[model samples]
Target chain A: MLELIVISTLNGVLFGMLLFLLSSGLTVIFSMMGVLNFAHASFYMLGAFFGFQLTKWIGFWPALVLAPLLVGAIGMAVERYGLRNTHKHGHVAELLLTFGLAFAIEEIVSMIWGKSPLDYRVPALLDFPAFTIFSTNYPAYKIFMLAISVVIFVALLLVLKRTRVGLIVQAALTHPHMVGHLGHNVGRVFMVVFGVGSALAGLAGVIAGPALVTQSDMAASLGPILFVVIVFGGLGSLPGAFIASLVIGLVQTFAVALDGSLASAFGPLDPSTGPSVLTDIWNVTIAQVAPIVPYMLLVLILIVRPMGLMGTRES
Target chain B: MRKLTLAIAVIAPMLGHAASAEDTIKIGYIDPLSGGGASVGEGGLKTFQYLADELNAKGGILGHKIEIVPLDNKTNPQESLVQAQKAIDAGVHYITQGNGSSVGAALSDFVTKNNTRNPGKEVLYFNYAAVDPSLTNEKCSYWHFRWDASSDIKMEALTNYMKDTASIKKVYLINQDYSFGQSVRTDARKMLGAKRPDIQIVGDELHPLLKVTDFSPYIAKIKASGADSVVTGNWGQDFALLLKAAADAGLKVNWYTYYAGGAGGPTAIKQTGLDQQVFQITEGFANSGNKAAMDYEKAFRAKVNLSLWYPRAVNEMRMFKAAAEKANSIDPVKVAAALEDLKFEVLDGGTGIMRKDDHQFLQPIYISSFGKLTESEPFDEESTGWGWHLVSRIDTPQAMVSTTCKMTRP
Candidate 1:
């Protein structure tokens, strides 16, 4: 039981941190621009494929740096030519535009790489076991993932919170005309924010592609859960996103560790005699319903508090 | 729905008869050509197209060219019905699909309903890889023929092999939450209990299908249970991600899976360096020491850029031809009749029977372990420098199981 708790905690924290790393860019864009970049995950995917191809051309180390840069550059171009024009048409237009980009990006990626999972490996340098929790050997690659996630979170906090550029960007978001009158390049700031947001997503993909399966559908699989995290965290709050990520991650992990069911909690009843829905609920173990916990929480949060756990604004 | 079916029944045959005059036999290939399941679907599509080309090269079936009309279902059951309707409108007599059993079930029912509504215009649904046992048993249709072994049969064979292995004391079950995965879990538990009551079941887990990105939590639970073996029916990204997570966490346990031979499966297994520890139960593998099958596999890889992942597809196509020839017609109803109780040599050198009772194929199923290859095992998967070493072979009798299918003939 002790081993279960300790190991589940470790795994949950690691997974939670991965979730954060994945959605950090999305959070950044949504917070600053108030327009959800639906293609953010697609940018992450581009980073992964770019990372894979660049790793082949150069190496994993060089590719890690270059992949995000390329993704960020592409993101900047999209913002300048694409999102900038669509911005005047309101959030729906922006949403639809990004949504379309997501599909187009997925198709293009498939055409280039095919629908196969790339044979991207963890660099030999960090492939060994970092430490053992009980008998389980946690790879150094994971420790690196956790460290990178934390560093990026802190770095992002510093960039958006403490820096002069951060202040100008935040001011530019709500008061673009004022920032323009103050002689700051408002349009350039917006472009940089989107670029940095996308680059962060790309960085996530570069790191995560090796950790998880790198395929065209990687974006779609994680897309819904990413929204759940952002919404549950109370949109546009970095710390909120972080906390939500960890909470959901921990909830899912701990739920998997528990084998409790309705039958176990109450007296034994014949599950087969009941309707399928009732039987399903009665027979289902907590481990089986771990995936549903987040959505359940999403519903609960929406019902209980629409502003979410940490939202400053009511939506 | 009945009204729509009647409308289609009236209009579809006119277009169907017009297209049928072109001297081409069309097989509508419906599966997920786009989305998470697309990799497996695309591979299946390529395999069937190759088979169609091969059959065409051999003077075609009854001098009518075998043409495959590809349709993307996006792995949705409703979308599959729409695609089926589209195929029927375009005059396709035969439709084959194998991915999600839910989609398979939907198509099976749709084909049956379509055939009933449109008497002279019938379509046969040939399933290559959807192995939900209910499809061949309680939900079986005269119009639906399965080339793959049911999940129950595979489990029976798997447990028969596991009954002798004394090392597997505690077994863990983790599968995707769906019809096929649920069947694998229930079948595994039931068969294991009957075969080896001494083997304690440590954990039985079912996660959402293709939704999980990280599997460390599941791996941690498996470690906590102290299981010596894991049995899963996870495929595509699910299988690959699970194995990769197991590798990352350094979880050492024998993996007995339903689809560890999928596209990225071998690469993930190789990365783990788990030499021959992962076992999968399938109809056949590349390095089964069969010369003709090996030559075909080589040629297939050279042409398709993919390993021969679906030996059952090869069986399905060849058997379809044999049935067509025996019936001496490509008419769907006559062909369906000819397919029943038909016997043909499978790709891996075994005579497989298409059982008349449930329209299920009875053939030899092989259990192979992916690991280091020997001189004799010439073919490796996904260029991993490792291949499937034949561990055990369950013959026709061992692989066969009784069915309860009650079909009403057209």
Candidate 2:
């Protein structure tokens, strides 16, 4: 039992950290720009495809740096031409525009990448087991993923607290009217923040691509899960997103790890003694319960703490 | 002016020679070139293009060059209808169907309607990938020819194999929550009851399309249900994700899956490190000792720089070419007649004869288990040191006669 819990927790943390790498950028972008970039996951997909192409030529290390830069540049162009023009039409319009952009980008990706999963390979350097828990070998790449996510989180916190540009961006997020009145380039700040947020998403893609399987349709597959994390984490709170992502990840992991049936829990009560409905639902497993944990958490959080763990009400 | 006159003069003879041909052989290739089904569509397209190239290389079909018109359905039913009309407008006599059952169903209706509207230019539809039983059974159209086995036929073979395995007592069923999945699940249930009544069904679950990112919950349920085996009809990412999640959860149950040929192929198994746990079913093409299949695969990989396991599209194209040649004409009605009566061997050594009863081909299916890398070479790999070994080859005859409509002549 202890071994199962330990392994599940470790696996949960690893997956949670990966989710955080994605959710953190989404939260920051949402908090600052107030428009959810529906195409964020699509850009992440492009990063993976781009990284795979680059890795074929140069190697994983160079691809890691180049992929995000390319994705960031694309994000900047999208912001300048697509989002900026749509911004005047209100947040809902911006949201719809990004949604349309996501669809268009998915089609473009298919056109270029040929609608198949790129046979992307994990870097040979990190292709060994990091350690074993309960005799289960955990890959070293997962540990690297967790480490990179933590480093990014710390770096982001430091920049937000200490950097000059961070202060201006923070001011625009909190006091947009005041920042504009101060004669600061709020639009430029928005563009930069959007670029950085997208770059972070791209970085996550480059790292997670081989692990998750780089495919043209991966964006559609992972998009909703990321959205669920964001919504469950309290919309625009980074810390909330972090906690929610980990919580959801752990819930699923633990659900898979634990094993006990409702019938077993009830001491193998006879079906004749119980109602047909109760008897029918008796043999339930933890794996069956894992997927519902996120949605359950979402409901619970919305009911008990609508503002999220570290979030404040807009009003 | 002299240069322009000279260029026109040079092209005029060739243009006149091409135009003076009796008629154009318009062959249409319809597939999901966009959206989620594009992976299969892209592969099918490449295979068809290869066949077209091969035919052209052999001095064309019936001594006239084959003009292949490829149309993208975008994995939408409505869009497929539009594309089918466009193909008809472009004067395509025979249409080659692509991946996805939904798109196939839509095109089946469109082709029937076209046959009714244009009596002279009948459009013969050759289905390569859509494996829904309804296309051959409940919704079988006279204009359509299905090259792939239906869900019921495929599941019958799988269930027959599972029935004899005494170790597989309790069974858990999970599939994608869609028409294709539902059809497979229903067939599985019927086949299990009919074949192995002793086998107990513990649980059955359906996950929404592209929504099952984590399958740990379902895996846990299967483990808790004490099921000795689990059956899934999931494909693509869902299949990959479910297999990985089940392995990660340490679910100690045998998994029987139909759609593992695409995403869980030998390369995927090597990459994901789940090669030892996955079992896959491949079409007859997998066992074909024919040099052409290997040569086609080699040439395809060289041209596309990617690997594809399912070569139904290429095989279907070959079948189409054979039928056209036998008829010695590009007329759809005549080609359809010739195809129904034709008896030929596919490159895979499987008999490619279309049963006169239902117009379905008798093909072979391969069942293989995932295991450690064996030194034995099964097929040519771009690189050595890794490949899947075949456990068994089940030569099941998929006779569509059981489901063919009475209206169609044998």
Clashes per prediction?
0, 4
TM-score of each: 0.96, 0.81
**Taking the candidates in order, what DockQ does each have?**
0.80, 0.23
Clash-forming residue pairs, model 2: A287-B217, A287-B218, A287-B220, A288-B217
Q: Write the per-residue lDDT of candidate 2 for residues A74-170, one digit (tens) a residue.
A: 8888887878888888888988988998899888887887666677877999987777555466677778989998998888878877898778888
Residue runs of model 2 more than 4 Å from their true location after superposition: A1-17, A50-113, A122-167, A174-188, A246-315, B1-22, B160-172, B192-203, B220-230, B246-255, B275-277, B299-311, B325-328, B369-385, B396-401, B408-410
**Leading candidate by TM-score:** 1
Per-residue lDDT of model 2, residues B252-336, tens digit only: 5677877766743444555655654556565653324456666666676777664545566666767777887788877788888
Error of 1 at A313 (Å): 1.3
lDDT of each: 0.92, 0.74
Once model 1 is optimally superposed onto the true structure by TM-score, how far is the C-alpha of residue A104 displaced, in angstroms?
1.2
Best by DockQ: 1
Cand. 2: chain B TM-score: 0.89
Window of ten residues with lowest summed lDDT in model 1 chain A: A267-276
For all predictions in the order shown, the interface RMSD in Å is: 1.0, 4.0
